[model samples]
Target chain A: MNGWLLAATVELGGAGAAALWGTATGPLPRRVMAQNLATSAVCPALLLLAQGYGRPSYVDLALLMALLGPVGTLVFARLLADELLDDRPRAWTLTWAAAGLSAAVVVAVCVATGPSRAMVKLLLIGALLIGGNVIASRALAGGFRGVRGA
Target chain B: MADAVIVVALLLVAASATAAVAQREPARQALVLSVLGVVLAVLFTVLQAPDVGLSQLAVGSALTPLLIMLSVRKVRRQARAKDRAR
Candidate 1:
C-alpha cells in the first residue's frame, strides 16, 4: 500500500520533470523528435508485455495513456510549430478536421462496445488528464506570451 | 521499497536541478536531464511501479530532449536575429 503511494508520488514527479524538461527544450531536432515520439508510443506496448505475469489495473491505464500520449505530443507539436498551417492553411485545417472526425468515431466505438467499468473509468481519467494538460499548457503559454508582450 | 524509492527520488531531483545549473550547452543539459530521468525511472521500477517508470522513461528521457532541442533552435534563431540587427 505504501509502495503504491510512493510509486504514485514518484510518478507525479516524473511527469513534472518531463513537462519541465520539454518546456525548457521546446521542439527537438526532427529525427530526435520522431525517435522519441516513436519510443513514447511504444512504451505502452512495453508495459502491456509486463502483464504476462499478472494483470495490473494500472497497466490498462498506462496502455490507454500510451495510446494517447504520443498522438497528443505530435498534435501539440504540429499546432505549436504552426508551420504546417502557415505553409498550407487549408490542408492543415482539413487534416485537423479529419483527425477530429476520426477521434469522434473512436470514442463512439468505445461507447458502443460498453467497456468494463474499470476500462470506462480509465478512459475518462485519461481524457481528463489529456484535457487538463492541454488547458494548463495553453494557460502557461498564454501567460508567457503576455509577459513577453509586455 | 517505499523508503528506498523516496530517497532515490530526492536524489534524482537534486541531480536534475544540479545538472540543469551546471550544464552550459543546451544539448548537454538535455542529456543530463535525461540521465536524471532514467535514474528516477529505475527507482520507480525498483519499487514495483513499472507503469510510472515507463511513463517517466518515455516522457522524461525521450520526449523531453526533443522539446529542448526545439527550444534550442528558437534561441539560436533569436541570437542570429540579434547578430543581424547589430
Candidate 2:
C-alpha cells in the first residue's frame, strides 16, 4: 500500500474507533457530538480512499457524505433539542479539528490532481463538509433557538 | 498491505453495528445507527463498490436517522398529549 492508502487506513481506523466508542457510551449531547464527528472523520477518509484507489468516480461518495452527514446531525440536534438545550454540546475544538482535517485532505488531493474539474469538485466537497459541519454544530449548541419548538 | 484498509473498515462496521444493537434508548440507538451507516459506506467503498457506498451514505447517514427520530418524537408527543388530556 502507498502513503495515501496508509494514511486513509490509519485515519479511518482511529477516528472510527473513537466515534464508535463515544457514541455508544455517552450522555445525549456527547453522543450527538460524536455522531457529528463521525461524518467529518469519515468524509476525509473517503476522499483519501478515492485517491488511493485511483478512482476519481469514487469521490462522489465523499461528496454525498459531505452533503448528508451534517443533515443527519442536524436531524438529531433538532429532534433531541429538548434534551440537549440544557447541556448544549459545544465541541468547537473537535469541530475545527475535523474541518481542518478535511481542508488538509482536500488541498493535498487538489495538489496531486492539479487544476481541473476534479479539483473544483474536491473543493466543493470540502466547503460543504466544513460549512455543514459548523452549521450542524451550531444547531446542536442551540444557536438557532427560534426553531426549537417549531 | 492494501488489505489493511479493508480490515479496518470491516472492524468499524462490526463495532458500530454492535453498538447500535447495544444502545437501549431509541434516540441513542438512532445516533449509533447513523454512525453505523457512515462506517458501512466506508466499508463498501473499500470493497471496491462506490456505487453501493453512495446509496448507503444517502440512506443510512441522514434519512434513516431522521425517520427514526421523527417517529420517536411523534410517539412521545402523542403519549404526552394523552397524559395531559387526563
Number of the top TM-score candidate: 2
DockQ (0 to 1) for model 1? 0.11
DockQ, every prediction: 0.11, 0.95
Range of the 10 consecutive residues with the lowest summed lDDT in candidate 1 chain A: A83-92
TM-score of chain A of each: 0.31, 0.97
Question: Cα deviation of B17 in candidate 1 (Å)?
Answer: 18
lDDT of 2 by residue, A71-134 (tens): 8998888788789878999999999999999999999999999999999999999999999999
Candidate 1 residue-wise lDDT, A60-130, digit = tens: 43444444444444433343443322322112232233234323433543454467774474455445434
lDDT of 2 at B73: 95
How would you encode candidate 1's per-residue C-alpha lDDT over B3-44 as one tens digit per residue? 544564566567566756776777646645654555565456
TM-score per prediction, in order, is: 0.36, 0.98
Worst 10 residues of 2 chain B by lDDT: B48-57
Clashes of each: 6, 0
Cα deviation of A16, candidate 1, in Å: 23
